[model samples]
Target: MQKFPFDAIGFDLDGTLLDTFRDLGAAVNHALVLGGFAEVSVETSKDLIGGGAKIMLARAVDAQGGLPADEFKQLYKAMLTYYSAHNAIHTVPYPGVREALVDLANKGVRMAVVTNKFEGFARDVLSQLDLIGAFETVIGGDSMGKGEDGQFLAKPHPAPVIAAREATGNGHMAFIGDSTYDVRAARGAGVPVVAAAYGYCDMPPHELGADVVIDSFPELIPALEAIGSAS
Candidate 1:
């Protein structure tokens, strides 16, 4: 077999590795109810993801008439509190994720998960699902600390992905994700990227600007091999 395209692969947690919209949506609904807003359909929650829990709740709240900053903050905390306990109850890996991960490991490739979810939350979910051990490290939005504006230096910043590369030995790296955040992060980090079309894509798969777009996790290896071959 030909050499694997990259030495390390950094993956986005939600949408890319796991199907988490149901739990995310539930948390958003919990916050919405607490804030006296109507709950949105769980399916629509797919569109609210990609930023983080706070943003997810914010969007849902905003759609219903918005909220005062103070009230919103409290609601955000409530969402987090509810989520931390029930996050994995309805969450599970997307099809072929486990097999693909195992295959990557057998290829001697290094892996890391870089997500906008809080570090503790990401760790807990992955650990509960028994997928945490597959990664060399799990870098959350908070892992890099907040920037000058008090916002997390998370996706689209490239710092976490670059850090993932460094932690995985820094030879050559690739990113796999499902949103513009992931594409921008990989581009900023100077790595090729594969978009997961089957995941919770915020835009059309072809429009995500990935080096390649895969419809399923099972297509990932072949896509990466082709990308590596061409590059």
Candidate 2:
């Protein structure tokens, strides 16, 4: 077995490991239509991603016209209901993701998924895609529970990423993701992060302030290796 750089690695789910925009967009559209808003192109969901499903739908809806809180809550519920059943419809591992994962596993690297999605939803989607077993744990936005502000203590908060490292039983950890949320989380946790440029990045990948940036999953190992070597 090849020795790896880090003892544990965490990944962001939606865009980093899988292309889930289509299904996410579909859910948003379902909610929007039910709320009497014009449906948006599924492709537009890519721009609304990174913050989670609720935020994704809210962004799309807010684009048309902001909804009343109670009404938006009901629409959000409807979207979750629709998404739970169809989360994997058009979702698939990004190109080279599986191969890269296999390679990492072969190197005996412990891995976890830290996503802004709800824990149950993340697990369900991963399970449906036959990718759940690859992770030692899946830490989601809801996993850390609602904060005093009534918001999820998720990425950009550092709690989930820290939880992932603990769950994976690794002190030396690294994170890979596509969004500023991921970058911020890793930074706040003081862990090295690699940006996935091919994912649904909320900002320019180069602007994410990652320790390294990779254009494809296949580049992950090398990027990690480089980080390791430099350290």
lDDT of 1 by residue, 25-85 (tens): 9999998888888999999899999878888888888888899999999999999999999
Clashes found in each candidate (C-alpha, N, C closer than 3 A): 0, 0
**Candidate 1 overall Cα lDDT vs. reference?**
0.93
lDDT of 2 by residue, 132-167 (tens): 999999999899998899999998999999999999
Off by over 4 Å in 1: none
RMSD of each: 0.7, 1.1
Residue 87 in candidate 2, Cα distance off native in Å: 0.5
Whole-model Cα lDDT of every candidate shown, in order: 0.93, 0.92
> Weakest 10 consecutive residues, lDDT, candidate 1?
50-59
* Residue 128 shift from truth in candidate 1, angstroms: 0.7
lDDT against true structure, model 2: 0.92
TM-score against truth, every candidate: 0.98, 0.97
